[model samples]
Target: METIQAIYDFLQTRTWLQVNDPEEQIVFLAAGEYNENYLITVEEIYGTARHVFRINHGSQLGLANQIEYEFAVLRALARSGVTPRPYYCEPDPGFDELGNGVLLMEYLPGRPLDYAKDWREAASIFAAVHAQPVDDRLIPQPDPVRDIARECEGLIGRYPDHPMTEARDRLLRYRERVLETADEFQTLTADDKPVMANTEVNSHNFLIDDETGRGWLVDWEKCVVTSRFQDLGHFLVPTTTLWKTDFEFGREGRRDFVAAYLELCRAKAGSGMDLETALRCTEIMERTILLRAISWCYMAHYEYTQDGRALRNEDTFARIEQYLDRMAWFFESKT
Candidate 1:
């Protein structure tokens, strides 16, 4: 209740709002990897409004000015209309008992994306975001292939107690392949232009409104300056699409999704990329993303196995197990 009281007191500072009862007005929303979200409902000058009070525990980008960086990106993408609008940001709110940083933003209305039905809608959201100007403040990942290799090495290295099972060896082999074809991967993205991209584009990261039919990608903790394909690939890869949902598409469906994104980008003012180039980029990006995802599953599986995670979801564990047990499918899809 201490956190609730602090939030109530904080809401009072928003001179433009009317919070009759903080306990009734503020509600716990969700706890993410780095922050706790509180849905704040207050009567604004015009009418009732909803905003998210995000308490940041840390930054995935490892920025000292994490809140500032995130808010900057939010503000930059506001014009794109696919992301939430930022109202205020306090990197240090002096919340010795609550959080390291705070962000107040417009609360969007929607539910976690349903991959089975909302694939094209999800593509539209990414297309709108990818159309936005790239923020120079973001850390650019120019070399995703090498980046995935290094990340795999770090995550897989920590599992010393784990045996070198076939799955582990295969994961390592993927890393070796990425490193070996490093030059080709570089060439694939050499002509690419940087865009505002969310590296984490899994199903849950996106929201689709049933009535209004609007789509949004709400989580930006992993946002970066990178090739648009990084996000598109993440969204399309089986590792992601099948993570939160069991939806899978053969080559035809994958082609159609990219085609939808291409058309949307063209509508957004004639994108510099065409269907063929985007398809090629998406293909290569998925290959490296597979390596990255398996490595992550290994790290997470070990953590969950050791009860290192503060919160564990049976669904997540089940999905990770499926990925490891049926590793052949993930590898075969790389081709």
Candidate 2:
């Protein structure tokens, strides 16, 4: 409720919603440190009105960086023609200096998209997103390998004290391997173009239609100017477990996704990235992800095995081990 009040007070003061009005019909939606989103319907002396506000409670990141990233995502989505309709975004200083930060925009109305029914459709959506020309104007440059390496090292340093020391150590070593692999790989993918690459493309990031095959990607917080292969890899690898489920597209889905991506890259040659370069990018992306997966395994193992929690989740460890093996095989096959 504190968060809701924060949003209300923040909004009330803005000229958009005259602070002195007592007849405002404001409604509470959702709030979090990431950002507080609200759907408000107000009635004036004349008629009814509606507004969707994104109260930017971006305490998790620096104010400037948070605001810039949000704006960038909106811009990228607008450019790609793949995002929900956004009416307005409250700019920085939209809230009290220390109390709150928010971004106001239109609220999209629709049921969440189902991943099982639309993995390929989702991949194609990303293909379309990547199809757009890379905007050098949006997002800062990133050193994927180095940044990931540093994260792996951080995990390694904590291994001694971590409950899943063994798994964490494996992850640490894997990270080192990936960095080494990237160093020897000469034909890495690089582009100075604008990209709508979303780093976190998990199942939860999408909203699906049960009747139609259409999907919309959400939470563009981590959208960056990274390789398109990285986006595809995120979609394919994390959900690799789908191979075991009834879901038709786990491993097979990933393969098809990769194929589709390669085809798209080939089709858009002069645009920037092509098939061969995307494959190399895929390798780099996989190396980075495998390290993270191994770390996740470490985290899960420690949390479960050591704490005596998730005892029934041994199957998870086995699955993780299989994932690692496949990654190892992938490395050897490419080499």
Candidate 3:
């Protein structure tokens, strides 16, 4: 109740909008791994006009910076009519007891995309994002291969005596081999151009409106200027199945998605990337994706176990082992 009042009072000072009944109107929407999200539907006092508020709660470390970056990207993409319009960004709203950052943006209407039914459309949305010219000052370009290796090394260094010490060491060696293999294809992608990539391309981040059959890409916190294949490979990987249940594309379906994206790229002109180059880049990027997922799984386990003192639940341990097995299989396949 107090939080609602704080939000209402904060909004009142900025605009003429009024929340007559904050308790009934402001509602909890959903929660993500890092933030608590809320929605408030506001109605005009004299007319039937209504507006929705998307309140993103960021209370974690380094989140304040992420919110700023997300706002910048959202503002840029909003001009293209495919992202939500960011209205206000409070990096540290001191009024909140927890001192969490708040991002006030227009609430978009849609549900999580069904990948199996909307693969083509999803690929098209990604192509559209890639088509836009990027301002390098706003979004930093990432070295896909090097960045993943550095992150994995950091995660492994955090836990030196975990029960799976041997597995972790082996994974590190495998990461090196993968990096070597990726270098072989470096020449193929040497001339690749950078584009805006939503490094996190989970199906849930893509909101699809059933009526219009159009999709809006949300969650730009991880947005970066990188190889288009970084985004494309993330979309086509089987790991997406973890978040998107309907994501069960076989080799042919995967090929179809690449075809759709490449056609769009060619149509845009001056993209300077051809079908063969795109496929090779995608193959290299996919390996980096696996390395990234491996790091995330290990980090999650470390965090859950409180630096290795606590015991993790069976299901949680099983999932972690499964990811480890997948990483090992990838390494063996390369050899």
Candidate 4:
């Protein structure tokens, strides 16, 4: 109740919202590990309006301007029509009610993407979202595969040292296989264009509009400057899809998705992305994204188990356990 009132109180501070004269509301939408979302509705002078009030826990990017950075990225991608338009940002910490920080953006109309129906829309969404130009504001990852492996090593370093010794050793062995094949595919494409990659592209992060059937990608908390291949590869990999869903695409379906992505990438004239070379870079990401996924589960599972995160999802913990149990199934070398 206090949190909701705080949101309304914050709105009252905003002259544009006119909280007193308007039929205003702030309802809790959802809460994730890093942030809590609320749907803000108001009857403004123009018309009924809605936006998401995203309250941050802290800096996931390890930068001072984390919220501002996300707002900026959203603003840049707003023109692309694939992301939400950022409305306001309160990056300064220690406000009356908004803890850490908060940002407001257009409340996108849609539901969590359904793999069976929304696959093609997802491909187009990723293509258009990645087509947006990249800049230095986002964290630059020149060698994404190596970077992923390094992060895995870090995440794994936490376990087997304690209660998860077996899981740790198991993940470590599979990670070695991932690391060995890391260099097999060319990391850098011919064009060498760095994309504004949404590192976390799970099905839940994507939304499909009911009426228009348009795709919308949300949750840019893990946004980075990396190869678009990394984004596409993560979306294709089972480790990602299996997180919130059990619907797995067959080999032919994957081939079709990649073809659509390639075609869509080529179609976006303003994206400045090279289709042929990017396809090559994407190939490298396929083999490496798993390593990151495994290590992430191991680390996050441990963290969530130990009450490391503020918001804990038992469903996520169960899936992490499943992934850890079958490390080979997810990451085994195909050759």
**Best candidate according to lDDT:** 1
Residue-level lDDT tens digits of model 1 in 1-335: 67878877765775535678888888889876567888889776788889898887766566777777888889889998889999888777765535677888989998998876898898888888988888787778888778768878887887888764666788887788768756775787787677888888888778788999998888787788877888888888899888877787778888999999889888986656777877887887888788888887887788778855544667778888888887778878786
Tens digit of per-residue lDDT, candidate 4, span 1-335: 77777777776676535455322477788877778898878787789988898988766566667778888788778877888888888876356557678888889988998887888898898888877777677788877767787777878895654577777887777667666645544334545567788888888898888998787899987788877788888887788777888877776777777778878877875354455554555555766787778777778777776744666767778887898888778755422
Runs in model 2 deviating more than 4 A are: 15-33, 41-52, 55-64, 85-100, 141-143, 155-164, 184-194, 210-213, 239-250, 262-280, 293-335
Task: Give the clash count for model 1.
Answer: 0
RMSD of each: 2.5, 6.7, 3.9, 2.9
lDDT, candidate 2, 125-216, per-residue tens: 77678777666765543666666567556545644666545545555566767787565333365343435687666664566655664667
Q: Give per-model TM-scores.
A: 0.89, 0.68, 0.84, 0.89
Q: Please identify model 3 stretches exceeding 4 Å from their true place.
A: 1-6, 45-64, 97-99, 307-335
Global lDDT of each model? 0.80, 0.56, 0.68, 0.76
lDDT of each residue in 1-335, candidate 3, tens digit only = 66667777776665535567778777667555455566776666565443434344442223447667777777777765677778877666566631345677777778887777888888778878877778665655456677667766777776666677766878688688668755655567677667878878888788899998888888776777777788887787665555446445676776788888888777776456666667767767777776766766776676666654222445546666676667666555334
Candidate ranking under lDDT, highest first, comes to 1, 4, 3, 2
Question: In candidate 2, residue 93 scores what lDDT?
Answer: 47
Quantify how close model 4 is to the true structure by its C-alpha RMSD in Å.
2.9
lDDT (0-100) at residue 25 of candidate 1? 88
Task: Report how far residue 335 has shifted in candidate 3, in Å.
Answer: 7.3
What overall lDDT, based on C-alpha atoms, would model 1 receive against the true structure?
0.80
